[model samples]
Target: MQTIPDELTNIIASKSQKLAYQLRVAWDLNDFLATITFAVVGTSVVSGQDIVKGNAAAVTEWDKYTYENETQYVKKYEFIRETGFPLNSVIKSRASIVLDNTSKRFLPHALPFGTAVEIDDCDVATGWTQSQDGIAPTISTSRKEGTNSLNCGINTAASENTYAQYDKAPSVIDISSIADADKKIALFLYVKDKTKLATANAVEIRIGSDATTNYYRIQIVNSEILQNGWNEIKKAATKVGTPVQTAIDTIRVIFNEATVPASVTLGDLKIDYIRICDSTEEDNYIGSFIRGGRFIKLFSGYNAYSIPQFVGMTDRPKNNIKLAETIINAYDVLHYLETWQMSTGYLLEDHRGDEVIAQVLADAGFTAGQSSLETSMMTIPFTWIKKGQKALDIIRKVCEAENATFYVDEEGIMCFENRYHLSQSPHTSSQYTLDYDEEIIDVGLEPTEVINKAKITAMPREVQASQKIFEKEGASVINAGETLELWAEFQDDYGELPCTAITEPTAGGATSYFKGNTSENGTETDKTNDLSIITWETLGGTVAKMIFTNSGASKVYLTELVIFGTPAKVVKEISYETPDTDAQESIDEFGLKFYELKNDLIQSADYARTLGDTIVYSFKEPKKSLETTIKGLPHLQLEDMVTVNEGSTGETYYMYVAKIEKLAEGYFYKVLLREKVIQSYAIVG
Candidate 1:
């Protein structure tokens, strides 16, 4: 047993001035080692290439590529770099997903399909007044279907020879919040005896700020007219007289009953329940985006393309580098990280407190790893790059093109990982292993969101169709220097044919002839087929011609006239393979969300589909959060893998740390972790 000194014992027993609680704590190299090794160990440099323990050196090259004649630069380097401890190692950081009481689906923007705006006094004459008419209309119960019918008698009609118009103020037709001028407002109503009118257009609806100018008019056609019984009608208002502007506020209903031919007359007209609503299905949200929301509303649901916090300033081209400006490249950044200064032949005495001091402090504070020479000296071969371009932009282009991720780990070191080489095996270090049940303090398991359908975009290589020969399917007889018309339909090629003529002389034993005034002919379509001919050109007009020259007068008969050319480009298609039929059926019933990627990163639709599947399966099919106590580690790192064990079932799970935050003065670490569901690049089955 160890005996404590009187002074120490007195301080421990004293209620005031607790030395243990008052001591300022600081983590040193020893504390770091006890928690997790910040420096690289399993990863090494070979021939100036950074390589991890299980991942081999993979390189990709892109050249001689163009987009609409504009050259593009693309290259990928699958160099495995580790910023955190070995995946299998038991580091101090513990993480899991926090499940909400309920799940919320995210969308891009709120779509207005049937958003309604009611019109006042549409069913009765109380909120309306007739134009230049002395008689007042009354509510007719005989014609009313729902006790909301308004009837205007024959005597109330205005201008017995012209028309009767009922007008409403701009406030009655709301158009203040409408952002899209092209979108139309629809009107729904029920009418009686519209067919008895004299003119073809018995009723007209207009929307505008003024009566004569700046308005749209829609006339109820004969097909939409109600004659014997009541008929419900719905139609979009059309532009009437030339408008001063597209903005509209007032609505007018006009009925030309006095224009009747004297033989036909509408004794009484009845109208019921008029309402205005938006029925535009097309999206009006072009070049408009909602930022800093829980989820970005998308075409079908909510989607956050990029998590802003995880995204860095170096990710954007304009922010990262500028010409004629003193900026640091990745090489200089790495070198600074290594020694906190640029490499020089001779060290300056007053190098301290230089301009680079700010950058050094701004950088994630971490010492150089083992492969500093490899990471700093590595060269990337790109198709094209601007002079003095930002090194991070080059890295981003390469990573995006190759389907890789570029991120700074919690250790403050940049790490690059190609999704193809994700399965490099867990870290071999024994310290990487952790007993989840014993070490985990508390855990939150996000309900898994398993998606069954995925939509992907890819530029798959196409097998071009050879210039096809579209023959007339019959022979034609013609004399030398005489023209004949022939009709033939070509599948894809329509403009012109490659060859001039494809015919043989009618004389026995006469050789076949083609265009170019030579014996040389186009390549044979099939060697096995005897009647194989190349192609024939049209007669410089709408139809193809067959003419025999006087040079070989042998009763020439045109057997075939064919045309040849390539097909149009088509997008590749792919299908998903689901293990659970029930889930697939549910997705089919509910309509799975569309996950589209436009960048031609993957070569084939199959690869794109697989990439989408990998992303959906790995990240948040079911997100989780974990909490753990690490006595030595001070910070949480991205992409750090931690083990979690279920206390009840004893099942183990390996989760990748996607996010982390410090709490209670760095005493605890809370992390948002994702599962390792993406096992392979392609479907094995």
Candidate 2:
């Protein structure tokens, strides 16, 4: 839970309180850009006209025409248009420019050029032709720019190129005068079904004459399309064959059936608009542009205290050009770990829980934040993290081994809390109490699953003494360009040894290769001098073999071989049954409820037993799970403790917040909670 000011607590509990939400996005690390708000009062602030910074007064003709292409940012005030939502106006006005949480950010984004010429807005279905391989073009209400978009569907039997071409009279725009060097086009499309378009070349944009001989084609890859909203594809115009610029009269959108699946149904594609402009006019627009990796902070509160509720980096942003609105979706900094893999393997021998977490975070380029992890309780004996494993997955395993929880806080910092975090500084009383009938808008309680028994299994690695596997009384010789093979079996007590290194008493002139197999007759893998120690350790076995090939001019002799490795063993298993008589009675009434866990990271028998005991104690009996809606408390976070008094059942519940969802425009929060059980732990002074 986030710490809040003392005064804000009283403000949250008030019956009638004001609510406000502020959104700020960082341009980089140090500079934050505020949301732009403007009012349309008569002709003072018109759309597509220059907005003078900090000046809302009537603009003179000189200033209006001089800076018509720029949008000025107002630093300290907001403006609202006096007229209600404008209807049927060529120029569209926006109340505010703020991206919501559901937007997808695009890569290589640019502002709409003010001098761009519209080829087609897809406002009507006429003046377009579709190939016989697919359905005809139709206008759809689902649009990104205008009132409608062009929809095209694929025939189930389409096995050839399917396309929608705008080649009819009045529909084909003349771009012959535009030189190829300065010619560029931008396309906006929304894919209804992504599964239909499976390959990178599923869509293509072609600009050429109606005869189809001269054209420039741009193939769209799978990564360029967004599954949620419109995708903007931009490319420079270049000729394909011997081209006649004056003869260019068609703009074609091809659905390459060779790349699309045969199972694609009708009506799976929608095109919003296509614009043609000079390459030099790319950045002439009237709005701000946002990209990924920017920081986003959301604040919610009343007049006096506006506390930050969510702080994270922008992941995606979706823009509506017609509405002049952009929505941004963000995730906390810890999410970066999911994209990073463990490039280097680690052999953790004697590291604490906190130390392990900190090392992993540092290697992944994150600074560790607050932690309540147990540092002195136990040290990890031996844990091997393989290369290419996800960093987040390894961290979760460490958390499971330590019995801890981890998350990113509101400050965008990674945090870890052990099982005893809450108990270490125990709360004697609830921080806040609420009357269910008055504060809660809705409430419910359901019985949770009961677990009377728990079992845990763990595998611990044990290092063994080095031993000589093979020895020969006579010299074993390999002639030049000849190869020899030797076989040896490990001791019966040590079934499979993870061989770390193989050494010969005397350095043999022949290049040596080694491998371990379960059986002597097993097919041998290709041997090389580059020994992968970790790979051999992972594939443990009993029998061992070596191959020697003579690459020198003379024969080579080898006498003995020795191997060093640690033995892999499944040595620990722990079981615990609830001791409470009530729990046993419930189990007898209902059949045995069992839970089991298997984690190789739990290296100690005592640790496994303690984990099982904790599980059984927590789930001994049926506990109540609840969901309720109450006035929004932005300070409340996941796993925070709260008390509620139920009027209907005349009961009190001390529960932990499981999930929280803001409802009705941030005025209320729908919370889910589970019964909290206080465990007894021995304390030392």
Candidate 3:
């Protein structure tokens, strides 16, 4: 047996179970494999895309393509997704009344009149999904009670609000269980959401498409098909249909309508499930390991055996690459996994997310399996990039146009990055190396984020209360002219108990609650600290406690503390300073003199001091030489030195990244740039 690496062995031997759980999670490479592709998506600002896999419950997340402009350098997100419920290699179906073993229904509302189920757990899926917004299902027991055929739930979109769109995803369903090689059975969907029926949407069951020309287009009605209530709509097999080329195992029931006065909805969809019933529903490929998944890999099979297995089917072992390919291959266009090392160049982990990277491939038109992950020396179409505008301008234009994230890959090819793993940050390499094109394209249209109004609380102002965050899932591409509006309603008592800023300890009534402020600095929300307390005041009751909120992305390290309040400075003590002002010396030399001077200053009679609510002290570099001999100056707190900017002119300054230590997050030490002056710099190792 091969011996484990020393670092692994040492870690295993030293840490207790508790310590092991707290330690940083060692990255497992095989668990993930992908190429930092040059190819992105089809459109600059698109509405949606597709994901196909044999048995893989694949997902896609998207990064909002944004920056100073189309040409400036942008740092995409480099993070992972939060853990969610896992649905392994199982094609669970509950199109009827959803229930637990004991027959207990999951969604009681769906029991009344909707075919409810989380059709897909893809973090990046929408349109006729299992959410309250996507493809929605409704039920009503119109007086036609006894007619057995009418006794069914209707799945339809009657209004624009149902699909959460002026017109995006009208209706869709999981046809993964029905579409097959047989041509006898056609699909039937119920409807009636629109007042007029002349303009109907093409309701068709699609199989597969080959980029263009080779796609299946099906429609419901040419003119008014169903009435106002539940009307049965049928879509028969195409007369020229030749074994519905779509991969039957992972089918997507889709609908498209244009120029229609009213929308269409589906009801009690029943298909020939028996004909396509998969024996075990566990799709095993040709090269999957007989043992656990690690014994064999898919990409290796292509490399060693020259054949590719079906994507999406396997209970992957820990850090197993062979198992990950099933999903990654299927999500090639979606973009959930960041393929770093396994490209045409070599196998690596760190991958970078950027428009420039995708442009290097898709704009040039290179397929993952067709092209070598290790190499991208394309000769055809001549090595050329299609540059459009700047990254920021692209985002603004796309946003204004109601499009998703807009990306500009290498060669100036403007498009949208796939929306595979919407929640996860953009992909990167194992080494955390950044990938960005030096050339940024800006079209000169500047964009700005409007400061949203301060939202008022709705819950009773008592106990701890927080606002509900409105998350935009799968913000994949950038639209050409879209403006996001964050509309919120204000409710006075947004809490059950007293707020943090309190004078009384009571749970209810006028004593505990107080109206919050409406300022941006959180001045009104955190104004409790401004309350006067001259004498010994009890901290137990009605006194409002100050709540400090740090929303800046970078961790802020304290350089010095500054308090603003009514208090007198009894005395001052020099933490560090230089003695002789008219001398010249190097920074190091000045450090020695500064430390010595600090010692003397502390001993001086004018150094007596006491703590107060507010005080200001200046910070300076130790310089008592011809080249730098300057008198010591008072120091400024971190707040006074920098500001977090999310606009045209604001700049973001980093403070430090520390490892868990001393009951903190991790182990670490601060390296001082100037110890005498207390300027500490972080060492990331």
Candidate 4:
């Protein structure tokens, strides 16, 4: 929950109050693009109006100005008269003058890019490594396509051999197939270093199977190829080694000097992208990284003292323009996790609940702040296999494993709290209290469902070892713009186990992974590598197929294929029943009430039993849930403990805030709460 000021708390406790809200959007911190304000009841004076000579008197609210020659302007309005004779004054006749009158309100403006914050400068080349030989290449802020560029510095000694090499993973690159498709492959490099262009004689680019094996070299000697900011240099690579390329593993850049000098250092030689493409298809092969850091800030207060209500990353704004106003709708940072999927081959095994949650958030580029994610009480291992699963789903699964709650707090930070959070000493006490007859406008209470039986199903990975479901040897090729489908049947009678992962163990593995759909009729789920069980009861057993498509200009090669999954024998189940006589009587009166949960993260029977007991104990009896409309309380957060007085029944209830909604132009709050109960036994003296 947010901390409210003492003065503001006193103001809120008063009978009457003033309310105001401000919404701000920006690309980064301290760099605001738009700031809008809305008040409950207020008036604003419109300013900046044009004035004409000999027109009606200036209005009280609008400012007036006069201009001549389109460049000079004065704040006062004036008119002039001409004299015809030297001694006698004469009024000159002139046509009625016309002036443009336009009025506009003053508003904040957006700042220039890279002026308010530092630009992202991380190396964005995925699945690649870099090495330097007598020359240091570092990530630089200057970029042409992506978040950053690579700075290739020259050697201090002129005669020394210096070069920087970027090496791609061997499993993802196939030069043999690329050469077969296009004999004249082109190397596209974007470089910029105007200050030190004269210190180098030429720039040499090398692409090869390895650092010193079969390779191709291109020498760029023209000074025009180097520019002040960014220049795209395209050159067709020529074979320098074995006359034919079999594989591509490394790309090297060298800055050469003609004369041997005492020292020659290229200050800033930045390279954006080093793309290898077919000579005819140059632009289609370039790729870029998506930029982030857009966020929103919401503030609420009375008069001048405002407190931050919500600060979060924003989705794309939806703007609606009408005759009188423009409204924008934006979502919070949690929306990204709901839409983002975990990458292929992402697996977590034998990790704690909090560790798994932290890993998932880190993989999605989010940081968990002020978190209370306690370790699970169970000693069993937890496993999560990422097969096109959303990040939010994984987080929720982990939360369920630990019986915890996860949310984005008001400060745009991820917060995780275990079930013990509310049951703990200080948190078990009410944080605030409200009088039903005085503070609440309306209130209603309804009876909630009672559960007498609870069941939990757990799937543990240790019960069954991962068995190889499919295997293939030798090379398999897929032509450009074509698809390749492979199928395999399950060897054992293990019912309903998902294929976990697909891998290539041979050297120089598959060229690239493509996105495709997976189904018996090719219409169901879509994924990067369509590896799914399409036919469960076909070919006398369970059969699965994977479809691979080559969407690029070059052909793709898969050297080996292996698929593995755990059998369904690992699944375990546990059940619990309420032992209290009152709970049994309520169950008999209301008919049997049941609740069940199936989670792969719950591995131990003890843990499952504890979870079941917690669920059944909380729902053993009918509980009163309340929904009330009350004065605005911006400091209150979800899951906060609050006490509510019931004037009709003359009773007070301590409840947990389940949900909160702002209404009536942010001046009131509608809140839903559930009764909090203690389950432990106490002995009387």
Best by TM-score: 2
- Give the worst 10-residue stretch by lDDT in candidate 4: 59-68
Which candidate's lDDT is highest? 2
lDDT of each: 0.36, 0.54, 0.22, 0.49
Q: Give the lowest summed-lDDT range of ten residues in model 2.
A: 83-92
Residue 347 local lDDT, model 1: 12
Query: What lDDT, from 0 to 1, does candidate 1 have?
Result: 0.36
- Encode model 4's per-residue lDDT on 1-685: one tens digit a residue: 5777878778777847855555544322211112211101111223431111111111100111111121011111111112111010111111111111111010112111111111122255454454443344556444444345665554544344344344543333455534533433233234333433334436666666654656666667647465444456655667766733444656655655443331333324555545454444423111221112234455566655567655543222221223222122334445556666665434444576667767766665543443445654333353544546787777777777656666655544556655455566555778788788777888888776678777777666543566665565455566667777766554544354443333322222242122233322324553324222222222211345566566655555543455555433455443443354536776787777877777777777777777777777777777888888877777776667888888878888888776676553436767777774543422233
Of 2 and 3, the candidate ahead on lDDT is 2
lDDT of 1 at 234: 56
Q: Rank order by TM-score, top first?
A: 2, 4, 1, 3
TM-scores for all candidates: the values are 0.28, 0.54, 0.17, 0.49
Question: Per-residue lDDT tens digits of candidate 3, residues 1-685?
Answer: 1123454434433322121111111011111213212212221112332222211111111111111110011111011111100100001110000111111111112111112112222112232233222234333222111101111122244434222121113223333443433222222233334332224553344333321233233445645344333333323334233333433322234344343323334332211111121222212111111111111111101111212111111122222233221111111221322221111211111222232234334332333322222111111111111133232332222121111233221111233422121212222111111111111111122121111111111110112223221111221211222212211111223211111222322112233221212233234333322222222222212112332222322222211111111111112233322233322333234242221111111122222111000000112232111111111111111011111122344433221111101111221111111111111222233
Give lDDT: candidate 2, residue 639: 60
| Candidate 2 segments whose C-alpha is farther than 4 A from its true place | 26-109, 116-295, 313-329, 369-376, 426-428, 462-552, 557-560, 565-582, 648-651, 683-685
Write one digit per residue (lDDT tens) for candidate 2, span 545-661.
556565555544543344433433334443433354536776786668877766677777777777777776776667788878887677776666788898878888788776666
For model 1, give the 10-residue run with minimal summed lDDT. 58-67
